[model samples]
Target: MTDKSIYRIVFHNQGNIYELYAREISQSAMYAFVEVSDIIFGERSKVVVDPSDEKLKAEFSGVKRTYVPLHAVVRIDEVEKEGRAKILPGGEQKGNVAAFPMPLKPPID
Candidate 1:
């Protein structure tokens, strides 16, 4: 999947809450599980993609790796630009993340 295809994932697990940034490996898969900190919660369970804004968010469910329609995701444009290649949220961007290079933009057009 492309970087724009990913966002932060948040959900409740066993009543214990957890958050992760999931990189969508494809339209059907995700990779790169990053724990999330400093999250914003509201009665609104959804957010919209902002073109001008570069930040992305993730969603998650305690029951499974994925739940809820990705379309329900508000921001769908902001993608992970991991140098040279892009990686979905649940997945890692190309390259050894251990080195952690700046994410590069994926060809979107």
Candidate 2:
């Protein structure tokens, strides 16, 4: 990836869908996790503010890096420009799309 690449990471968190924009993303050293860093947020000087964006900014503030379980990650995309980071209720998903079940541990065990 180029230095200018911006990543859009979508993940499932406690029945909510989190959409975030970041300058960096990679496989985490931790087992079965994806590392996200350099989170991007809109300028605070704007008169119009999105509540969801504010919530997300507060949630991730002071966090240098974050790891999302591989199973919880919905999708990751490389976009030319950053978008507003927000959270959506998971139950609001349209159509028949469903998250694939992932076993927590070895079934034989």
Candidate 3:
């Protein structure tokens, strides 16, 4: 918690797992906004997660936020402390869970 560090992890809420390795690679901190199918309630919610303990707890309370190894993630993002944006990578588009990528500039671009 001294200098800003880069951390990547897969957020686990119940059985559903949203892959987030690729999105947290280069950034000092990452925010993963995922649409999870709530097994407990049978509903979907937009869960925002991050690498920092403070930021994660502040933003996500009811939702479970677990830190995961960056190597474990497929998609990563070098985002600010705000952990801006959310992506729902599966489920019906009409439903709360939708397949979407993090809004970031391509490396080649």
Candidate 4:
């Protein structure tokens, strides 16, 4: 594969589904998080405006790398080209979509 190959990462975050394109996806050193870097987004063109994509761009604007929880990841695919990054609302209306629950901390004696 060429160095420019893009990867599409689909993951769940705070009851939302995030679709992102990046050049790198790997197991993070930070334990159970997946490391994603070199995120790719469609160029700003006057002809088209995607609110979902715009929201994602602003959310990840200053981030160089992101570590996503492994359990939240739904799928990952290597693609020939990058696509618009977007965030989709996910919940009961989306059918069977739910965020993983975190374990409760033990009570201090």
Question: lDDT (CA) for every model shown?
Answer: 0.34, 0.88, 0.34, 0.84
User: Candidate 4 — which residues are off by over 4 angstroms?
Assistant: 93-109
Summarize candidate 1's per-residue lDDT along 35-107 as a digit string, tens digits: 3323223223338643212222233223234443332332333335322111234334466453223233457
lDDT top scorer: 2
Q: Compose the digit string of candidate 2's lDDT tens values, residues 1-109.
A: 6779999999988777899999999999999999999999988999998999999988999999999999989899999999889999866447788567422332565
lDDT of 3 at 98: 36
Q: Please report, as a residue range, the 10-residue window in candidate 4 with the lowest summed lDDT.
A: 97-106
Segments in model 1 whose C-alpha atoms lie over 4 Å from true places: 25-109
- lDDT value, residue 65 of candidate 4: 99
Q: Which candidate wins on TM-score?
A: 2
Clashes of each: 35, 0, 10, 0
Tens digits of per-residue lDDT, candidate 3, 1-109, equal 2234333334432223443322223322445433222111111244643344333334455753334433334444333442322333332237476333322333664
The predicted structure with the larger TM-score, 2 or 3, is 2
Model 2 worst lDDT run, 10 consecutive residues: 98-107
Please give, for residues 24-109, the per-residue lDDT of candidate 4 as tens digits.
Answer: 98899899999999999898875889888888889999999999998788889999889778898764554576345522334779
Residue 88 lDDT in model 1?
A: 31
